[model samples]
Target chain A: MDEVRNVIELKDVTKDYGDFKLDRVSFAVPEGTVCGFIGQNGAGKPTTINLILDVISRDAGEITLFGQSVDRNSAALREDVGVVFDEMGFHEFMTGRDINIMMKNIYRNWDEAAFFENLRTFSLPSKKKCGAFSRGMRMKLQIAVALSHHAKLLIMDEPTSGLDPIVRNEMIGIFREFVMEEDHTILLSSHITGDLERIADEVVFINGGRIVLTGNKDEILEKHGILKCKKEDLPGISESLIVSSEVSSFGAQALINDRASAEKLYPGAVIEQAALEEIMIGYVNGKR
Target chain B: MKGLILKDLMCLKKQLTTFVYVMAGTVVISILYVLSTRYGNLARVGEQLLDQNNGMSRVDVKNLGSEAMVLFMFLPIVCVGDLMNVFVADGKAGFYKVSSSLPVPLYKRVLARFLTIYTLFGLGVLVDALLAVLLCSMTDIMSLGQFLGVIFSGASILSIYSALMILYCVLLGYGREQYAQVLALLTMAAAFVIIKFDSVRFFVVHVLGDGVGFDSSVFWKPLDFIREKGYVLLGIAALVSVCSYLLSVRIAERKRGVI
Candidate 1:
């Protein structure tokens, strides 16, 4: 078997905006995996994405894409990288054909046939102005542009936000098809944990400009559990195990980071597997 | 880099359509004025201005047609030559995010904008040159060289203004294009006043004083300078554009992601 190679790497990356700072952020996404960059709004998600793309200057540390420093020939390295932002960044007057024309000149590997085909696959009208497109259609147009080029890596910041479920699912299907190739990778950043939960092979959780948790998705989900017990019994549980807890009229529940340890410590306590949403919320609440 | 220029042109599509209209108008007006001076109502006016024997010379009186044509041509070459709309359109669309993500170096990105100014000016000058050849062939209003010289002078001046505007646009960022335009004009005006302060003061005190008469040299001297020395303006425009492009590239690279 071949040794797994990382597609994207950030080592001690730091960007300070005075009010909020991404503090020495470090993470890696191996090839052939969808790494869900989970964070709430204003949780340094877009900033991190911008830094990775070399769109913004960083105060400290380094970023590497395709095993090369972003500072050196960063523009050339983007030949294989496809980027999507939450809001459509294209001009309103531009049609799908217009984008294809502009992008064909910009990217060395731009496939004109593939671009129109992607438009067809997404049901986006080739002649209609993008300004007339609905929010969902606008996103689809961006995705179509991203996929038209033979890009090996996709970096998206909140691409699925504000879309209807059906459209979001359709986008997920497109992303799934993209990752079917062994070398393709996606670093999808969004607050929608459900979408990430359904497709992400790895997860990197961030809160308040800091990486709070990260690892394999299955391992993270398997390790975290919601422990339900009486308010009186909650005090007996180790503080190390409780990520966060809330007490109610009838009982108290705690988000236990070490579910197995909690289980061994209290045999009477009822523990249920925590969803990605529960884990995210528990971690966010724990931060506050 | 070609892609970025194409995108900027797309943003300026409205200006392009308007440019065509202005070109057609300049041609129509120049032809109509030439015909009027030769056989129509303007002929009578020219004869009277010459007959009255004012402080104006026969050369000055004869240049009335050329002066009108130069002013008319200035409308297209100077006022219509702005690339400010591109910045406004880019800002409104938030294209900075998209442009920054492309596989283009920041210096090339800045060069594309500077090149756009020349592209528009090139088109304008080309059309004006063709028109000049046609019009000067049939009439004595102005020689072809003089017409081209004046047109190029206008283009060079506007290019300088546009070059400054590009620098200001990058420094100030979006939603402030109006300020950039004003600052460019002010900078040009300050440079002119600083460079030719003595000439300006002499003209004000000796030419335009209360008892002083209308000095036809006031008008004809500058026209002669523009006709004979327009290359100076072109050289200055090139120098200003080079400086602006270098500074814009540095600022844009430092700011990172701003167009």
Candidate 2:
């Protein structure tokens, strides 16, 4: 993949809402890639997405979407950008057909046939009001609309936060198919790292409004490892290099981001590949 | 723009059933009132017909026709409720975020909502007027010209009121529905006070009921008032709509954070 070609770019974006501040945060999602935006709740993932979509104003920083500055061409840029929120924000009284009609006029390139096709594919009712839909159904409806719009970039804020495993897997499959085109890309933020591990090509981890780590999925998984040792040997391990450490009666496990360095430094330690969830948890709860 | 209006109409579809029921009820009540009074006293009915033939002035009957026209005022209250639903429903359901994210310009969306409410209100008033006419036709109490005059005059007042109500929806926040109802009641009370007070009779007669009577002379003054004051009301409406549009745009531009 060409890493330099960025479809979505944020440069030192900062937003201050009096009581809270989103510090200077920046990341990039290259074209034809699925960038998993991993963060715990209140990690400023949604805030960053809102700024990029220009739903909320930023105090400082530049957001570029689809290779154009978001500030200069918000309408033009939004034309090709599809967005989905964790909660379906549509009038309860409105049906799928009503939404399609409303969007048809709002979007210059709205395809009714494509929208209905997606609705049928997802088994969403055209006449059923949104208020009656279950959470999963509503999320599916939002995704159907987002994908049918021919958007190049799909920015979803926790789209799979509350879903059964089967539905979550199905959505991940749909997302994978959505990015099959060379021009298509997705930037999804979620605390559910398992789904990301299954489909994402790259991962961007944000904590307390700051980007802690960002790189290829394979590289992050391969480089970061968990070091397990007997409780007695835990005192012998170097605390400076451990990202996070968990103590238990049976043993102690420490997450070390640099697996090769940990192996060289502690030859007696048992190093095992760490899952994305464990790595995220360790990063959030810093090592003691 | 058409699509926005269609969506609003779809949302209002449930309310249409209520509107129809109220309209039918109004018609039935008016007809019943006429029947109970006119047919119960055969001798008095004969005397009324004889008086009409003798060209005796029926000013009291004309005042009653004017009073009957006030029933159309209820239309604005209902229409305001419908418009408020659009905002409250969207806010509560989180649909505003989804709709705002669409590529449509914010101003166009606001205007579409305004047009939808205005159109629906206009249609409701028209139906009420038709019902009034049908009820008046079944009795000998009001002349056809007087009945038609009442309908047209009532519709004119409703047009101005509907415009003001739309402005109210845009200027006030979500709970403005209750405020609008209170304001409507206060306006009626003020009108009644002006009608009763001898000192303000000139103002009320000139401002409130200028075109209400059959005389062409009485129509000019209030028509001019509407013309002059119409600009002020429209100007305020335009300003409020623009400001609300900008506010919504600003809200959309804010950065998301932990709430």
Candidate 3:
């Protein structure tokens, strides 16, 4: 692995919560690339991010952020990494200006002018208390803070979960600009696959606490295809190659991992490109 | 650290206003009671302690001081509320994780909260002392030395109480509404028991009012005993503060995801 080029890397990370276990997982986000962490509600995306942040301890395996072991240099590593949670985590009584002042004290690289400019860009009120802000506004404030600090790496957990389409589109553009700088990178986790498809360079899909797929977004979409065939032709398809299959009175639809191989084997079947959502659903169903 | 302290102080300003109002009310009532009983006509008493049969005699200056101390207990309770407010506010706003995740050490954060609460408590005590002195000057009942002693004693006791409150707030983790109600009930019960039982009265006297010439020697004797034992109590309070801080740090480190 090219460790030098990788900003965040997790190797065989495992966290056990008695009844629920985050199984051995491995993935890496290359420097200057956006890695989309795709998973369902209980797919352990938050758990993995938590482990990487050292917010929660893992049972086994090593995590390296900024080319240093997380445990050995967590405080220093955190200085350069900006994190945004799905929910806004700030005192309701504090205004955006108050937050800027407080955060400036924490991060030596925190720029007040940049923070205020971003707040203006996001159209957030500087003096209004956070409690008065709507959900979209709160998320924008969080992002504004995350970007104002000169953090080299950004880790966001479902930052756009409930945002309106327009705000989501705007945020996606901001994220694109964020990674334009050579040293900056982002690892974004969200259940919304459509946004990931539009922004992510690499896609890592997790299901039931395990990594089901990891590859380039375009490559994964290009290789995986949905085959629509008659019910009688379903038996002709090999179960080993089908990730998942939906049966109906009219026909059977199956998701195949390798379109080229499936096409060679089943010449009569109709194949179409599968969206990221379809691929996620097929992998989560574990039909293969 | 400066920013954290400023934030804490800004959040506490409203509660500080309430404390000032309560202290002012206490001083006004004390002045009214003194005037109604002892010095209704300041011209009548000429080197003689006014005596009355089956009615209020010249109010015992020491007993008056003890009453003043009782009034000041609210200051510490209010200070405790200030400390607890930080936790409750953060918990309500979902900001605990955000603040804890900062590079600043958890101990420093806890210390900042403590300093804010105690500094406010100190200011409350100063206001109470000023009010008491003003009331005493109007009543012509106590000397400057005696007034200063009462203020110093009241502040010392408040410091210990504020420390205990900080420890309690940390242990409870913002789930203190029920605990607070139960504690109020227990305090009322204890007050009733002490008032009704002569033995308990005697114990209170021996502990708080040994040398203080108060009509209710029962209350001041035990307080005097407590004052004598102030170092030990203060030590315990300091130890509790340190332990609670360490426990809070451990909790912060173990927390995963968001709270």
| TM-score for all models, in order of appearance | 0.98, 0.79, 0.83
Model 3, A1-288: lDDT tens per residue? 744488888899999998888899999888988999999998899889878877778999999997899884675678888888888988788899889878887787889999999999999999999889988899889889888888888889999999999989999998999999989999999999999999999999998899989978999999999999999898889887789999999999999999999999988889999999999999877633
- Model 2 chain A weakest 10-residue run by lDDT: A70-79
Cα deviation at A100, candidate 2, in Å, is: 2.4
- Candidate 3 lDDT over residue span B1-259, tens digit each: 6667777665665676776677666666767656654555432442133353433344444444445444544443454344556656666776655754555555566677667766775676566567666766765555544555555555554554454555545555566734644453454457448656886665568545694433455555655544344455446546655665566555545553222
TM-score of 2: 0.79
Which candidate leads the pack in lDDT?
1
Candidate 1 global TM-score: 0.98
Per-model CA lDDT versus the true structure: 0.89, 0.73, 0.74
Residue A173 lDDT (model 2): 87
Give candidate 1's error at residue A57 in angstroms: 0.9
Task: Determine the TM-score of chain B of model 1.
Answer: 0.95
Q: Residue by residue across A49-70, what tens digits does model 2's lDDT show?
A: 8888776778898889878897
**Highest TM-score among the candidates is held by which one?**
1
Model 3's CAPRI class is acceptable
Q: How well is each residue in A29-121 modelled by candidate 1, as lDDT tens digits?
A: 999999999988889999999998898989998889989999957899889899999989899999998898899999999999999999999
Error of 3 at A109 (Å): 2.0
Q: Write the per-residue lDDT of candidate 1 for residues B1-259, one digit (tens) a residue.
A: 8888888888888888888888888889888888888898998887888788775566886766778878866777764578888898889888899888889888888999988778888888888888889889878878888888898899999999999999999999988999999999999999998999997777878777753745677768778878778899999999999999999988998887679
State each candidate's chain A TM-score.
0.98, 0.95, 0.97
Clashes of 1: 0
